[model samples]
Target: MMTFWYIFVMAGVTYLIRMIPFSFFTKRIKSVMLRSFLYYIPYAVLAAMTIPAIFYSTGHFLTALGGTIVALVLAYFRLPLIVVALAASGSAFLLSFFV
Candidate 1:
């Protein structure tokens, strides 16, 4: 019962955190600086969350590093997201066999 209540509360809090932005920010943001900052926040947060996990994700740090480099290169070249993800995991998978 306690766990169920906690989950319900958390779900509501998460919903409001995401909902408030779309409900309120109906118009395009007028500030160039603020808009640019907002555009980059997702990427920054993604890096913050994923980078540490990348180092410890596999048996070898080098394998994960190789995969990250492959993913970054593909992303820089503007490849599709699916291709980048597949190539990254494939690179890691192949390299793991060797190491």
Candidate 2:
């Protein structure tokens, strides 16, 4: 069927797209900036993923906002990542339960 062919072609294209980057990069030399960027990319990605969730959970702005501030401070103080996450999530949960 046409659908089967379409799926096959799409799968091939997706695999090639995913593989090409590894193939290209594995053969190349790395630069200092690239190393630094790679090191910070996870933090940047974590912030990008978490920040919006902190501000907009359950349609309640203030509770989430307050928790976010607390989490930021905990993180700034160099608390463990798990502790920071737990503090933020626990604060948000308590606030939601009470307010």
Candidate 3:
């Protein structure tokens, strides 16, 4: 069926995109700028994806805002990531009850 072909093509494309960098980039990157850019790409991508969702993921804006603040404070103190995530969600859950 057409749907099967579409999915097959998509999977192949996705696999190749992920595989090409590993096959070609066997040497260590020598450019400091390029290495720095690569190092921060994941964080930048995560922030871009997460920040907008943070504001809109809850029923009320204040609850989400409370969670964001909790997350920021936890991150500032360099707490474990799981602790920060759970505390943020807990703050949002508790705030939602009162909002």
Candidate 4:
């Protein structure tokens, strides 16, 4: 089936992405700027991926905004992850009734 081929191709691509860096970058990277860039790449990628999901998860923009605001405030206060997550979800759930 086409689905099987798609999965096979995706798996190969993913493997190549991980393998290529390991295969070619066997020596220690000496450039300070390159090392710093590599260090921040994951966080940059994570924010890019997570920010949109946060705003769109509630289906309604207002509700999502309400939740995101609560989450950001809680996170800024250095609250526990569980507390932040629950407060965000609770805010979104409560906002859903009004929006």
Query: Candidate 3 lDDT, tens digit per residue, 1-99?
Result: 999999999999999999999798899989999999999999999999998888887878899999999999999999999999999999999999898
Q: Return the TM-score for each candidate structure.
A: 0.77, 0.59, 0.80, 0.75
Task: Please identify model 4 stretches exceeding 4 Å from their true place.
Answer: 22-26
**Model 4 pairs in collision:** none
TM-score pick, better of 3 and 4 = 3
Give the clash count for model 4: 0
Ranking by TM-score: 3, 1, 4, 2
lDDT of 2 by residue, 3-95 (tens): 999999999999999998877877544788888988899999988997777588746897788788888899899999999988988888888
Q: Write down the RMSD of all candidates, one decimal each.
A: 2.1, 4.0, 1.9, 2.4
Worst 10 residues of 4 by lDDT: 49-58
Q: Pick the candidate with the highest TM-score.
A: 3
Q: State the RMSD for candidate 1.
A: 2.1
Tell me the whole-model lDDT of each prediction, alpha carbons only.
0.92, 0.85, 0.94, 0.94
Pairs with backbone N, CA or C atoms under 3 Å apart (clashes), candidate 1: none
* Stretches of candidate 1 exceeding 4 Å from the true structure: none
Q: Write the per-residue lDDT of candidate 1 for residues 6-45, one digit (tens) a residue.
A: 9999999999999999799899889999999999999999
